[model samples]
Target: MAKSEQTKAKIIDVFLGLTNKKKWDKISVKELCATMGITRGTFYQYYNDIYDLMEQIEDTLITDLNHRYQLLPLKSPNGLFPPELFDSKYDYSPPQELFVWFDFCKNHQKAVSSLLDTKNGDAYFVKKLKVILAQHINHIMDYDGMPRDGLREHFTKIFIELHFMAARTWLDSKEEDFLSIREIINLLNTMRVGAGFLSNKQMTSPDFEAKMKFPADREVL
Candidate 1:
């Protein structure tokens, strides 16, 4: 609760508030400073730019997840995923000492939604996320047999992108009917199980793709 830390947090609050209202690219330094009631010099003292501020916010969340919440070292082989990472259904406050990504999202839903709107995380943030996910899904990806590097990478990529899509859909539409968290969980479970099955099966990629079709051989382009 030091003055400097408090000031920085207030700036962050204003920054996140702005993100909810506009694209991250559109929010300028002057505007954010005006919202914070601080001079540009003050902002510079703590952050280099808006991106820096956002990254710091992310860093703080990661720190809490790792140390305070103990969500770090995420369980693997189908461990620490949606619904499980989130608090109980329709709730935000995690059970005592139980923290997950949803806890942070609940607090900054608007801003996080904005950043995700950019889809930039697919390259940057998701790279960081994949590290955690890989540790957890690696076992499942090769459950039936040993997978080559390419196989693991390909499955991991799909897992991260699909999860992001599901998460984005849920965050954008908070309504229970918009997209059930259970459905998202099911999607993830499918990927986990699919990875295992594909590992054991001798079918080639083409063979697997051939079996997956849309009704008739009608292509909609």
Candidate 2:
């Protein structure tokens, strides 16, 4: 890499290291420069301030994440998957994109973990991730012929929140023997399928129809 690019990367690396050691708000440009044996002027050339540096880092990560997700072959020109692809008789395989996403997370575990830390991390960054996940989930639900009504909308919100939190937990684990990406994907798929089954069963129940009615329309208990 060029000298300037290397310097910038080194700066980011130092910042991420500091993030792991202390709360984000407590990290200062002076300390970062001192740690890197660089002058404040050099830091200012690359970043306006600490917050600016953080915003740039987060923007880059989120942009890359969104691009990766957009590349998933969830739909064709018609914006829907082949109906047969959903058939129970057909053997199903997990999308390579999922593996890619998890691998990215693993590779950037330091940055991701630091940024997603509950107490000190950026909530805005987490919100951006959820937005990406929500879009992806909506596309999958669309292709799966799931209704986009109130109940399903609420379910989708819950689903996104659950998976995002699980991902954060996985990233936060310090153990070397944490679940592998493929295994986690399989578990997630199982949860999704189980949820779908319960949703279908619930929708088919007679009580579901009655529950859908206006509260006042129901017979008084």
Candidate 3:
């Protein structure tokens, strides 16, 4: 890497370290520079201020996440098998694409955990993640022929939040307490598969009625 890029990376690394120990508001540019033995002028060359650095980091993460998501070799609805084909006794595994995602999170654990910290993290970053997850969920539902009504929309919201909770739990856990990435992936896949089965049953029920009206302006994120 070039000298400038290396310097910026060093700055980001130190910043992430500080974020783990101190609240976002407690972090300052002076302290960051001091920690790296760099002058304030060098810091200004890369970022306008502390908040600017945070925003840039958040943007980089989101962009990379979206790119990775888009590259996933997701199958179409026609390629999906019926949920009935698998039972509780069946050995279940998540798609490799999901494993890739979990791996990314694991690799960036510190940055992700700090940015997702409820007390000190940016809500905007969380909101951006929700938007990305919602899009992915909607794509799956669309391909699976799931109805896009209010009920399913609500389900999507709950599903996304459940994932966030699971991720946060895994990310924040100690090394000794940490669950394997595959285990977390499998757990999430189980929930998704179970939900698929329930939704299929619900739609096929004799008394089923699609009465819920999704508001035109309702935002799932």
Candidate 4:
């Protein structure tokens, strides 16, 4: 990485570190610079203020996720999609490259928590998330019988919002409320089922069953 990018990343690291420890409204630019071992001037060279720094962090994350989403294969390879899944198959589990989105949140729990804060406006992060997610909606949703335009796009947007908030809830929850990844994936499948869009064959497929396995299912086996 270039010197400038490294400096900015360090500053963002400090910002996210502090953000996790305290309320977003309580975090300050001076603290970020102090932790980064840089002057306020150096900080300003890269960002206008704390919010600018926050937006930059969000944008960097979103752009990387968008890039990852782009790399995902449009359809499962000849052997990747099981013959058992057939036409109703949609890789609802996040695409392999986009799995980085999960890693980003896991590594930046505090940062993700900080973005969920509504003190300023969280719509910015949510909107950015929508863009990252919306593009891959087709990969996850069954499109064999549906048009790509109109209602399809609308529900994809809604499902993106639902997925985002569900993820946020999972992040924000304590052990009691925590939603495991499998549970969440099952919830997503359930959502499709409820939408009257999921098919019986798809629901019963080995591909779906493989991805939807729970701990209990393993125990039973």
Candidate 5:
């Protein structure tokens, strides 16, 4: 990449690093620029605002996940919800990506919490999930008798929104409630199957509520 492009990428890395250490409000563009020895003008040249950088990070993460999924031989019954999907063998374990993300949140707990303080964050995740799930469903659904138009869209939205809400709640919890990436994958599978994206037999165990709980030692009063 050219020097300017390289600088812009470095700026994004610095911003995400800081985001892990502090809240968004606590992050100062001036400081970020100073740390990287760049001027505010250079920062503005790349992004309209801090939130723009955030959106970029979110988009990049999603893109990376999609790319990772494409490389794996996910052809079996358990392929969709397999815990091994995040293993290091593929150079991109889902759980490791999640850990990196959650650790970023934990590092910048105060700032990250504020982002989730409103419905906007939740809504954004829901919308993104809806799009992803819709595509995934269409790729795997039994369409012979299935309604191929409006009903699929409706089901996709509702199921994705519900899963998005649950995921946000799990990630934003004060305690380290979500310990396993498999649990998250399983929950997502249940949501997809329940929404008719997959066959009923494809659904995992039904005791999802109990399974979604925090560790016994980490329970809050």
Candidate 6:
């Protein structure tokens, strides 16, 4: 990596570390730079302000999750139809990448959750997540029978709602609610099913075992 990019990453790291330790509002650039052994000028070269760093962190987290999902060896639900839906290899199992994601969100619960409250309907994060889910569903299901635009709109809203709710819980859980990757993946799978974003064949995947898994428990969601 370039020295500039590396330095910027280190700065982000320092910011995230501090964020985990205290509220974002309480942490200052001076403290972050001091913790990272960087000068204030060096920090400025990478970020305009603390808000910029926060934005960067949020963007990076979502981007990383999407990228990781693309790399997963998911089996399309083309052949899995009703009565046994969600039986595809894409069983809601989160991969290694997702665990890292959970850790990040859990550590920065307050700051991250605050953003969700501020930017629910209009946030780029929510929009990007919609697009991500739409594309994935398109590949795994046959949406040609329905109005694509309508499906996208409905599915997006459901996805965002579930994600935000689960994210909030994951961040604020008092018990060992930190879910495994499979559990999170299952939660997502359930949401997609509940939103009616499945192919005819996918609607019968043996994985679902009769829509019995909808509205997963608190731990999974």
* Structural similarity to truth (TM-score) of each candidate: 0.62, 0.79, 0.79, 0.61, 0.46, 0.50
Error of 2 at 70 (Å): 2.3
Deviation (Å) of 32 in candidate 1: 0.5
**lDDT tens digits, residue span 1-221, model 6:** 99998998777666655655566656788998889998999988878888788777777767766666667675533442343333443333333333444555665565466555432312665566556655655553442232344556666566556666777666556657576545775777665554444543444466654564465565476
Candidate 1 local lDDT, residue 26: 69
Q: Rate the local accuracy (lDDT) of all candidates.
A: 0.59, 0.73, 0.76, 0.64, 0.54, 0.59
Residues 1-221, model 1: lDDT tens digits: 99999999788778766776676656788999988788999999999997888788777655554453353453233332233322232122222211244445556566556556653331455466556545444544433233455666777677667756766777888486675555556556656655544543334355766566565656763
Q: How many backbone clashes does candidate 1 have?
A: 2
Cα RMSD for predicted model 5: 11.1
Compared with the true structure, what per-residue lDDT tens digits does model 3 show for residues 43-124? 9999999989998998888888888887887766533345464343233345554665677678778888888888777788
In the order shown, the candidates' Cα RMSDs to the true structure are: 8.4, 5.1, 6.7, 9.4, 11.1, 8.5
Better of 3 and 5 by lDDT: 3
* Candidate 4 lDDT over residue span 90-171, tens digit each: 4344344335555556666766766765453356687777666776656554433333445667788777767667667877
TM-score of 2: 0.79
Give the residue spans of candidate 4 off by over 4 A: 1-10, 17-28, 31-38, 45-48, 76-101, 142-144, 147-154, 174-177, 196-221
Best-matching candidate per lDDT: 3
lDDT of 2 by residue, 16-73 (tens): 8888778776889999999999999999998999899899989888888877776766
**Model 6: residues with Cα > 4 Å off, grouped in runs:** 1-10, 13-38, 51-59, 74-122, 143-152, 174-184, 194-221
lDDT of 3 at 107: 75
Pairs that collide in candidate 4 are none
